[model samples]
Target: MVREILRVTNISCGCNKVMVTVEDGSNFIADAVIITMPLGILKANFIEFEPKLLDRKVTAISDLGVGNENKIALRFNNVSYPCLYGSRAFVYDLEKLSDEFAANFVML
Candidate 1:
């Protein structure tokens, strides 16, 4: 059996209702809806809703930081450093590396 799927886009909200624009430029209305967009997009103020969110909720949202960091893997066919010196090595002030490199290395 085949199922029908509806794609709603361009959502706007007011105090008590939400308006959505569909692919065909048709409009839809709803009483309440849950938006599960990325926190980053929410933080960027890409969408707006009326009857503004509660003060505490707004504060929480503002305080939340989106992890914009990235990771890159540099795989090697063979180990460049000898293992005979022990398993651990020391590096000072590692934060000097680029943000992406620092985030990736911290995971190791």
Candidate 2:
């Protein structure tokens, strides 16, 4: 059961169980755990992991560059496609259409 939203300070993936510690000195243990924290938090080392992430995983996370992204949810009362708002980016490219577009766009 999820309690209040508290600041997570540590995560330990042990052989028996996974432990998640919050700033309020509370620990949550479970048989399995899934963390969905942002890349910034992982890159900043905000929360300490007990054993440590693998070297390749650490390198991959460190290599990931974080950029500014703005998200806005719009509500259109009269629109037929209620949630079909187009998300656009002002990308300047020499080619009209290029495979580079695929590389730049990521769902998450």
Candidate 3:
């Protein structure tokens, strides 16, 4: 347990613990985990989340005032919890991710 974690692919907060998956398909679970990657890395979107982050959070991290290229928003009016559509905004499905990836996770 003395090696460095590289190529983190996904991080999920399940039940009362955190689960981290690496590019090598290794899984690590813990009470809590900390990520110290730089802002640039975050903007690059090299990693993915089980419950994908909302569009707003994604925009904030990826924006960097680079323009609309970073914003990715898909809309579905026929679906429930329709927040924004056809805009440069991102929204997550509550029923899909549950508390694991709440839309307002950043607020917490």
User: Which candidate gets the maximum TM-score versus the true structure?
Assistant: 2
| 2 against 3, candidate with superior lDDT | 2
Model 1 lowest lDDT segment of ten: 81-90
How far is each candidate from the true structure, as Cα RMSD in Å?
Answer: 11.3, 9.3, 16.9
TM-scores for all candidates? 0.41, 0.59, 0.51
- Alpha-carbon deviation at 16 in model 3, angstroms: 1.5
Instruction: Tell me which of candidates 1 and 3 scores higher on lDDT.
Output: 3
Taking the tens digit of each residue's C-alpha lDDT, what string does model 1 give over 58-89?
Answer: 88998998776789889989764323333343
TM-score rank order: 2, 3, 1
* RMSD, candidate 3, Å: 16.9
Residue 5 Cα positional deviation in candidate 1, in Å, after optimal superposition: 12
lDDT (Cα) of model 2: 0.75
Q: Provide the clash count, candidate 1.
A: 0
Model 3 Cα lDDT, one tens digit per residue, 30-93: 8888777767667887777767889899977766644334766878666454455444444434
lDDT of 2 by residue, 1-108 (tens): 665567789999878999999998889999887767789989999998889889998999999999999999878667432132235323333234355643544221
Between candidates 1 and 2, the TM-score winner: 2
Better structure of 1 and 2 per lDDT: 2
Residue 28 accuracy (lDDT) in model 3: 89
